[model samples]
Target: MGSDCFDESFHGYGEFWCLGDTRPYMRALGAIANLAHRLGDVDKSIAASTEALRLCHGDNMGQRFVLSSLLLKAGRFSDALSFCQVWLDPQYDGLNRPRGGCEFNPPNPELLTARLVEWHSKPWSPGNLLLNAAYAAFGLWGDCELARQYLVLGTRANPNIFVKVLARREKPDGPYSRPRTTNGTDEAHDYRWLTQDLWAEPEAWVWINTNRDVIDIVVKTCAREGCGRREMRPLDFKKCGGCRQAFYCGPECQREDWQAHRQACRQANAPPAPPDSPVYAMSGFLNDEGALDAMTLDNSDDSSDLSDLWEYGVEVEPY
Candidate 1:
């Protein structure tokens, strides 16, 4: 099946599904992504996972987790964070939350928008999601405060995340094979194992090491250079409409800080360039029925923490 079939089925049934089920197509794409990732084809894996997410609007197969991992691995920091935001605040972003049985809607636009959605930036609880978001913020944007908030949230959701992430270990090259549980050690280990190389980089490791002891996540200070006021809740601080990272005590602080923060703000909020060409072609492998069937069959045991969170019966608290 291709885009034509995906579109026909998507519009015909109001949801692209197979035999009253949505997993087969999504699973096939995910399997393709996993196979590509295992073979070190990051770009192909990202594209495949991205297509998987588009097909399964409800993310029944947890394609977002795979996409996020690949984006970060490829060092597409801005893209990773931007992709993660689609699920952060569906209402604010005009995103259709398909979990409520809504009509199918693709998560990202073909022509990516630069409009920032900051009214509700709190991410749903999952150590890996928080960790990925944190890495994206810190990577090229160099926004340590935003990264710190994510790290704090990840630590709160799963206490063992930082320890395992910062530990020295051989990074696993394939998709995580174990069942994941919400806020469990398994979830932490899975994230740590898959993303070990990202953290192993000197810059990322130093940042994690430097901020490892920061647990007082309750209060955040104004972004203005001289303003020392801090607020426990984000509602009390006004966020910069451009970057959505800077928080101000009031308009006075924001106005005063504009000149100093303009360049970074623009850079942070700019729409990313289109994805680079895939490093390798896998059409032959995908077309091989036997290979596709085998890969999909083996994916039955592969579950992501975000996908399994609800099934694990845990209430996700906002940080």
Candidate 2:
């Protein structure tokens, strides 16, 4: 009688079936999450989205994106940032696979290669992910400097993101009938449409407005340890080919800075070490005390410190 009453179509039951996690089941769960969000039950929506992500580990349905936004909406700022870190970047399974796995964050090597996307050279250049990451970082830590870095990268990924969404006073209009282009105005509109309320908080809104200028400010000074010389105009300084983030006045300065920049350059070009990797654990044991912290933008004892000003904290005087 019990067996007869049970619905065979529902895959959420059964010991051997792995909860019937088929594509349809995942989609249905995703829809429920969306509905919950629309209904203003943010916590419930986050739960639903998180479950969907766990069930379909690779996030083939792009549930991670939704989950990320929901996390911020629910005030789970740290979780949102951590989630972005784990999922956004490329994860290489060096021991077993020749290249890397597509299942990225949690490292599911069996996932398809098609699931893998090319990581932009700039770490934060992946549309909403890094943008949310920046917001989450600020929300969690109140560290404007770190948040600014994420903001910069996020803007690079989608140039229209800031102006189209954050800058405007009016909500972006959209039937959203037209297909969205990658990093285009339509994409920005859709993003704004989805997460408009999250950015409206007084503190969050102020942070966005204050830091928005950094995206437009180009720092053309030499990125060497001690020599901070700004060019009169653009193109005077040569950017390092390795990371393309660091600029040098000349080859001599570049050569002098190589020692300081080597580790960071390698990290920028290559996939980051896994969180569980021994590299992170052994860092303290290997390096001198405070050695890692000493690698600053300007470690010089000269006026270079004044020239190599950070975009976030420094104050300016009126003419």
Candidate 3:
């Protein structure tokens, strides 16, 4: 959803650096697949989700989540079960650790994405997915042993999630990623607002997700209004120097659209808030009674405090 995150691309990377995928392409691919499913394009949905899974090396729960759901829908019970069980395995290690999310074990992508909004979606933990796969195994394939083992594993993983998080706190693993904010202020709320803007609306999410061409990397119409010129490449448009949020058809279109562009420029230049530090929030949750009372929470609004960090998790990937 943002510029490239590859170490190779960072010749001091920023928006202007490139308009390609940030590394770990699973999130966008998953979103595209999910959007396709919503549109009832089952074949396209599976294709997108399957491609996402193919790119994953067991690190991304989001990809696993989408692929498993699509497999079940496609009646690929064995593949679904096998995929989820691998994640459930204690030894299922990858280049990066599984994103159990800033909260909850076996992080649920749909719930995490919709946490700020009033939405009901299931989590994607190995335990939950195992149960899903088990249901399919027993019902669809008549595989009793597989179903039983999966159920056992699912239940075991479910109970131990919070415990594992607590243990993580007790035993320091390594320095975790810290939260960064613009203007040295609390950025969590701002981040939640962005995700809410992106995700809270069903149509908007689909529109944005579908429109971007990070894969095919082609565009016909200009991003600017009233400038529907054709014949495009990925880097054809000139990115606005001010906010870095938009790309002009050219210098002429940018100058011509200056009046409307001013407001956007401010927003683009404005520093986006960062999500709350995962470690800090988890620790606060564990000590909810009084431990977090002294913590300086930014009273940006009365909307939500936790949603900020939740949205931040998605913002890092922006799909």
Q: Best candidate per TM-score, number?
A: 1
Q: What is the C-alpha lDDT of each candidate?
A: 0.55, 0.54, 0.39
lDDT by residue (1-319, candidate 1, tens digit) is: 3356556344523244432455566567778987888788999988787676555454545566667768899988777776665555445343333431222233232222233222223222555766777787777457456666665565555544554454443455554454444445555555665577787889877776666343234234888888998764323554666555576777777777777877777776566433342212111111212122111101111233222111210121111
TM-score, each model? 0.54, 0.51, 0.34
Clashes of 3: 0
For model 1, the stretches where C-alpha displacement exceeds 4 angstroms are 1-4, 12-14, 17-22, 90-124, 212-319
Q: Which ten residues in a row have the lowest lDDT in candidate 2?
A: 285-294
Per-residue lDDT of model 2, residues 141-215, tens digit only:
675666666666676666555654454435654324443334445555656766767777788777766663443
Ranking by TM-score: 1, 2, 3
Worst 10 residues of 3 by lDDT: 282-291
Model 2 regions lying over 4 Å from their true place: 1-21, 92-124, 172-179, 212-319
- Model 2 has an lDDT value of 0.54
Which of candidates 2 and 3 reaches a greater TM-score?
Answer: 2
Among all windows of ten consecutive residues in candidate 1, which has the lowest summed lDDT?
292-301
